[model samples]
Target: MFESAGDVIKPKGDVNAPSGLQSVLDVEEAAEPVLPHFFPDEQNDSIPRLSRDTFLDILDGKYNEHYDNKLIIDCRFEYEYDGGHVDGAINYNDKELLASHLFNSPLEGRTLLLFHCEYSVHRAPLMARHIRAQDRTVNAECYPRLNYPEVYILEGGYSGFFAEHRQRCYPQAYVEMDAAEHVRTYLRFW
Candidate 1:
């Protein structure tokens, strides 16, 4: 009697439904809830801070097979750096000079970057933060944003490192000089 009009379609039983032909609403309802993929919203005060021992390990190649690309920036006066500094550290007293150097030669594939002054309290963290800011701004302009290497500030600065690893220090000038005099001369501001 129902076939007199033509043909009538009937809903299939759940057992007879096609394997991959489920309705969109049913699929969505059955799917697991999705979670966001992003960093937590914790307030980052500044660049990451590395302890003196950790910094020394990086310098000594404990973390990587090779330590050639690692850079240690000494953000102190040129005279102070010349007097004595870390073995392979580069002097960048002025922010402008540091920024210019970073712009000219990007640190894309570097393994690690360490920044320190007399005390890691101020200059090192400040410069590290500046470098991070530059990376964010400059990478934004590129077609595919560049991934900057991680930057760190030495926790206690050069003084702390020197006290612990005097053997790794360079030039013998500062190492041989009077410790008290050195503190008064270079670390007075710190």
Candidate 2:
């Protein structure tokens, strides 16, 4: 389904996926994910799933054999992210902007892109879906092949992951998005 270089994983010009890869827009409109993902949805958009334990493994270098690097994209409000986030995670909440940048970016290397918000529910999945859609459009003529094919969503999101892996977080703390104390901070973020 994909072609792998030392740093960049490119899909083979030809791929044989069961569902026959297509853009996310094929199933849903250009709507961002809302509400929590209490149950899995039917949109099998091909975005891979990554477990928290496996996330830790990747951080510990277990996936070095497959991915040369990884990027943790925290898609929460700026305040929520600033309060606490995965170590080394970059805060990028705008899906449209992110997609535009990723498609046009000159970033090199094969890297696993891990996306998440408070829960691995809405924002995270939607952003991943958007990126895939934009990627499809960018390489429409080429079909299934993509510039960066290794996109994943961290299961249970940061809340679940941080609960068990606090030691791995930057400041070893987790902050809820609705915390009362950040009311003033939220305004600035907005």
Candidate 3:
């Protein structure tokens, strides 16, 4: 059995015992914590979060003078991304590929990196944790003279952003779907 405390899912049984139970665990023991999807009960101070309006402002060049570089990564599935996504945002469905892109890409000059998914709850946080864990290695190799960019997750994900700035979205066909049907279809994973 499993019990959910905020975003962390805890096993009801002895998870540490040497048995067949290891594979079932979703999180591994590590110094840096890995967060689950955001629930009303979960409170984490490590992962920085950005509001939808703030993100929109950034996109509108509100912070252009302050931030020299910026990147918005959308971590949804290919189809969901194909359906609709933020302008200029890159789609990276696989975590491994995202990691590789971060490692090989030029990010030292960047000042901000924003990550988001359908709900800005689970996948985004998970990816942020992964990047934080690998920060040291990336800095050593990728940014020898520069500093790491400030990373943040969209507080409500694409859903929240879309709710507020529907005009900014692309692929009208996907965004024009029936609200109820769209929710049922896209949010089925939740």
Model 3 per-residue lDDT tens digits across residues 1-190: 3354643665556776776333434432232212222333476646678877778888898777766677788888666677888888888866778778777775555467789888877888888777766665654433322234467788988888887786787764234223564677657655
TM-score winner: 2
Kindly list the per-residue Cα lDDT of model 1 for residues 26-105, writing each as its tens digit.
42222121211122135355566776767777777776654236778998766668877989999887777787777787
Task: Identify the runs in model 2 with alpha carbons over 4 angstroms from their true place.
Answer: 1-45, 183-190
TM-score of each: 0.63, 0.71, 0.64
Against the hidden true structure, what lDDT does model 1 obtain? Answer: 0.65
| Model 2: per-residue Cα lDDT over 4-80, one tens digit each | 46325555455666565565655433332221222346655566667787788877877677765668899988877
Clashes of each: 0, 5, 0
TM-score attained by model 3: 0.64
lDDT of 2: 0.75
Candidate 1 residue runs with Cα over 4 Å from true position:
1-44, 66-68, 141-147, 173-190
**Preferred candidate (TM-score higher): 1 or 2:** 2
Q: Rank candidates, TM-score, best first.
A: 2, 3, 1
Cα error, residue 36 of model 3, in Å, equals 23
How well does candidate 1 match the true structure in TM-score terms? 0.63
Best by lDDT: 2
